[model samples]
Target chain A: MLRLCSENIHSFFASESPDEHEPPMPRSLTSANMTGRAPGHTTGKERILTSAMLLFARTPYSDTSLRDIATAAGVDVAYVHRAFGSKAEIFRQALLTLGPLDDIAAGEPDGATMISRICDLAFLRNPNRVEDVRPLHLLIQSSLCGEARAIIAQFIDSSLALPLSRAFGHADAGKAHFALSLLSGFVTHRAVLGPADLLAIPEAVQQRMLQTALMNAMLDRSDPGIQGQIN
Target chain B: MLRLCSENIHSFFASESPDEHEPPMPRSLTSANMTGRAPGHTTGKERILTSAMLLFARTPYSDTSLRDIATAAGVDVAYVHRAFGSKAEIFRQALLTLGPLDDIAAGEPDGATMISRICDLAFLRNPNRVEDVRPLHLLIQSSLCGEARAIIAQFIDSSLALPLSRAFGHADAGKAHFALSLLSGFVTHRAVLGPADLLAIPEAVQQRMLQTALMNAMLDRSDPGIQGQIN
Candidate 1:
């Protein structure tokens, strides 16, 4: 059973053809180059984030320690501390590296457009950009437990709320927040609860349905009446 | 600062009169003298679940321990063990008590209705069913790690997929999995992620937008040729 499961997982990954849809990773940021500190001040920070992201993708946050992250990044513990004030800060920064909300905000034309763009950005960045999507899942699972909840809650609030409200004309902060909540929920669900076919359903179908639902939500929000009612 | 925050939290909880839309607990099953348990079966299991739910709601899963739950439930460790085989099992069963998906499934008219009903049910349950809503945020926060990821992933797969697929009538199991992922994401996001002001975008607005989007998606599935072609 284990062998079969392994073979199936291998086939699934093989079928995905990483090159086709995988987001580009900066050469400097790749796991392979994340080690051996450079003379630049922020290089160590970047390396730490890269290593942390990779490890985070594979392990739960509780299981991951600053020392472990430092080892993975080939940096000293002191260097890790200098770069990020704490584990929470490092994890937050690492998540930001996946794709910053600021970039999504900058691309939108209006509140409605912003919502669509944000959803698209989240979907695109999530499955593809993060090396393994698994660590993101682990982080969320950990949030269900301790001090991590506050950090996770704050990260989500800022990532989705601040920029989303800005795009929604500030007056419609409520609407923007609601929209953000919906979008994040969708993205997190996919990130954590997916690879659905092994236990539930196939992957392609799930993607299509999600894209459809998201597009629908976007189009509905575009209507002036709908936006007015929400505001 | 902590005291201030606690005071504010207390004020918020105290001021908010219980809304009519609270979720129905399996009170009929777990009430003090319910018929569900075998005679002489100590109500320790139910108490453990109650404590677990409360702690899991306030604290992240990792930070919460079996001992904490035992202490809160006012039961011996041995009682907890007799009731739940493990902490994960306790968490899982506690969440299940919030509402069974099967209960929702039994009430739907068809696949489309199933989605609508589930959404409505989740919305209604979210405010009332603190147990269900609490774990959602925690789970999302923890998804960044490993063992937690596995546990949550399995729960999503087992608990959400099959029932959602049956409701959707998608011939392909993969499609069903995707549908559930999308739904779960939407619900969780709505339940947690943002401030009440942001979330309070008027129920009418939410309903209209969600219904329109849902209908559009359904139509697209019913007639693939018109997919993306329609506004």
Candidate 2:
């Protein structure tokens, strides 16, 4: 099952920038060198975070060592120790770099488009990395572990739930959390079930199911305006 | 990651019979010895198939040894070899014992009840094993492998799609498959997200969403009777 761990997290995440062909490997542990704006230039700390992300995504916590991350990042092992302090801390930072749920949370109230965007984020493959989405996959695969699960749950609460609720015209996190749960299930099912034939279903039907279910999960029925549209 | 393998395939499958306290260790595994069944007795081949199912469900194919299964089943390892020929064959046979699609395929047409039943199978846990359902969990965990994915896809086609189509009063497998895809997505979401608060969204609304979506996914506009009722 360790083989299920992806080696492509670095590629998947780095593919956002065209020139990041190689991982960020600092030549020296100087903050001045790290502060440069070149495409692949990363501070020693950023290098450790990205390296830790890639390594941790591919190997479970106990199997990964600080030395492995340092070597991958082309830095000294002691540099990694000084920057991240511990493997757990490195993992937390790695997930932190996935950016906030601001894309979902900060957007205006457009339930249909918002649902589609959420689905896209959860299920779409990055154009550059055909079959990899490291951070999402890492979170899903490691969700069975207590520590990773807690970290992810916390992230969802602060970044996803609160913002999603505000978008739906309610301050309650319950609706946002439920809507997210449904979306997560759908994504996970598609990945694990790999029911390719299901793709043959008309795109319209799929969209309808997704939009309707999401609206139902996220909004209250007290509003006749939304209720009428839903029916 | 290997630790994710279920240690309970034995318990999950064996819990079907109360008296199966000791694994079936055939004193003689010859064809003649394989024939008779006294109340609770099993043929050597049956024992091997069940044992393989339990073991394979717990551990990945490459990691599990015949010796481990034989020890668990209380049989000689060579007996497993003689009986099933190869690990691959044993795994296929184990899946086969999850039984034919007859239950789903042969049922009376009741879309509401059928949808409810399908949901139950996908989401419900065994009353005895509070947190696990070994075969489903095994399939999800091992789906990254080609063999398990193929077997599961085949099972879904036969068990889920075919019968569900029949229940919808048509022979179209498309509707059933689409509905199933949605249900599978929902189930996978709950398992991975662990969003317990989603349960707070009143049972009536949940049931309505399930039933309505399933009906929409499974029925065509050509059926005025069903369409009228759905509205």
Off by over 4 Å in 1: A1-21, A24-183, A198-205, A221-231, B1-21, B24-27, B30-76, B79-102, B106-108, B111-113, B124-160, B168-173, B190-192, B195-197, B207-231
- Model 2, B1-231: lDDT tens digits are 323322322333334442432221211222322355663577667767656655565555545667877887789989989988876677666655543433333348365556655654544333232123234545544544444556777777776778777776777775566567666555445554445555566645654454444454454322242223222
**Residue B152 C-alpha lDDT in model 1:** 64
Residues A1-231 of candidate 1: C-alpha lDDT, one tens digit per residue? 000001111122234455655442232233333445553554767768867776655444555789999998898998898778899788776666654544455546564455445544443333233453432343343433233556666665666666666654565545544444445555555554445473353334444454455544433434343234223
**Each predicted model: what fraction of the native A–B Cα contacts (within 8 Å) does it retain?**
0.27, 0.24
Q: Which candidate achieves the best DockQ against the true structure?
A: 1
DockQ of each: 0.20, 0.19
TM-score of chain A of each: 0.60, 0.68
DockQ of 1: 0.20
- Real interface contacts reproduced by model 2, as a fraction: 0.24
Worst 10 residues of 1 chain A by lDDT: A1-10
Off by over 4 Å in 2: A1-41, A53-65, A108-110, A127-135, A145-147, A171-175, A201-209, A219-231, B1-38, B53-64, B127-137, B145-147, B170-178, B199-231
RMSD of each: 8.5, 8.9
